[model samples]
Target: MKLDILAIGAHPDDVELGCSGTLISEARRGKKVGIVDLTQGELGTRGTVETRYAEAAEAGRIIGVSVRENLKMRDGFFVNDEAHQLQLIRVLRRYRPDIVIGNILEDRHPDHGRAGNLIYDACFLSGLKQIKTAEDDGSEQEKWRPRYLFQYIQDRFYEPDLIVDVSHVWEERMASIKAYTTQFHSPAGTEGDATYISSPEFMEAVIARARLLGKRIGVPFAEGFLSKKNIGISSLDALVLQET
Candidate 1:
């Protein structure tokens, strides 16, 4: 199915912590949005692959995305090679999204940067007719390329080229994030290894990052994104505010 937006991440909860608010807001506006996780985060300290899948599914439901797919790539060792790119390319061609959101180019986790490069390369290669991919029905799919590509801010702070005001959907965004019980801020009864993200402090940092981005647009919360190309707007009013 054609999707308006496809958000991809190196791991299951990455998208949730990064751009789920923007996804939620856009879905509310009648846009079809989906998610593609590069890995199941199997190497994560707290959750097993099976549990991560269940949590990811719950998160997808909370975010209101039309689909959520995992490539099942090796969590920490996946490379930006042809085999991995083809996997991403197949999904890109299958969904034919107009816009694509990917992991931060550089982050606290090495996987994030690797996936960012992989997604970027797959996006470019998917547009080439020479690269063949087939759907499950055995029919060959046409080459497709997403028009827009943006990288969501994650563990590391990036000076974003664009920021979307997501203050209105902030609560829902947090709800979706909390859905990954095994990954972050676990409830009293749930058991998990205390990792960097298992504590509530990590979530607080996420909120702080959103707040920092929102300050640029005078909003309570926002999501920041980085783009390789310059962004354009139709009018001066789209500037949000002018510099003093």
Candidate 2:
């Protein structure tokens, strides 16, 4: 199905952690939103792949996304190569999203950076007519390129090119994130050994980051994004006039 916004991530919860708030905010406004996970996050210290799928679905529901898909790329090892690009290109063409939000170009996790670069290349290559790709039914797929591509801030901080006010959907956003009980701290308790993200502090830090970004624009909560291309607005009315 066509999407107004497509959020892609290297792992299952990556999208939820980074851009789910913005997705929720948009979906609330009746925009079509979807998510594509590059990997099952099988390499994570906690949670089995099966549990990850279940959690991802629950998170998608919380975020009000229309569809959620997994590319099944090798966790922690996928590379930005021709084969991978073609695979992602097919999805990009199929969904025909107007805006694509993906992983940060560089991050604390190597997989995050690699997937970011892979997404970057695939989005551009998807627009090339010569890069042939087909659908599941063996029919040829048409070339499609998103009008805008932005990377959500993750793990590491960079001055964002834009920040979306998401205070209205903050509860839904945090609920979507907490849906990954195995990945993040939960009241029910996780089954696997604790890791850096499984700790309560990590969740606290996630909230803190949102608040910090929100403070930049006089909002209660927000999500920051980076864009390689300049963002344009039709007029001054598009600007947020809240006193900062």
Candidate 3:
């Protein structure tokens, strides 16, 4: 189905930790939003692939996304090669999203950077008619390119080109992130051995990051995004005015 906004991530929780608040905010405004996970996150320390799938579904539901899909690329090893690009291109053409939000170009994790470049390249390549991709039924798929592409900040922070006000959906957004009980610290103990992210400090950092970004724009909470291209709006009315 066509989507107004499509968020892509290298792993299951990547989108949740990054742009979920923005997605939830948009979905609440009646925009169709979806998620595409590049990998099953099988390589993650805390959760099994099966548990990841279940958690991802629950997270999607909490975010109120119209659809969520996994491309099944190898976790932590997928490269930005033609084969992987074609796999991602197929989904891009199918979803035909107007705006694509993906992983930042560079991050602490190599997989995040690689997937970011992969998504960037695939979005451009998907627009070329000669790329030639097919549907599940063997019919030819039409070329599609998103109108705008924004990369959500993760792990490391860079000055963002835009910060979306997400205070209205803050609680729900946190709930979505907590859906992955195995990945993040949970009050109800998880089964696997604890990892860096499973620590309560990590979750605290997440909230602190949001508050820091929000303070910049006089909002209670926000999500920052980077864009290679300058963003434009038709009028000043589009700007959010700080409360007196």
Each model's TM-score, in the order given? 0.95, 0.98, 0.98
lDDT of each: 0.90, 0.95, 0.94
lDDT of 2 by residue, 14-89 (tens): 9999999999989989999999999999999988999999999999999999999999999988899999999999
Off by over 4 Å in 3: none
Write one digit per residue (lDDT tens) for candidate 1, span 20-97.
999999999999999999898889888788988998898899889999998889999999999999999999999999
Full ranking by TM-score: 2, 3, 1
Question: In candidate 1, how many Å is residue 34 off?
Answer: 0.3
Q: Is candidate 1 or candidate 2 better by TM-score?
A: 2
The clash count of every prediction, one per candidate, is: 0, 0, 0
Q: Poorest 10 consecutive residues of model 1 by lDDT?
A: 184-193
Name the regions of candidate 1 deviating beyond 4 angstroms: 237-244
Cα displacement (angstroms), candidate 2, residue 172, comes to 0.4
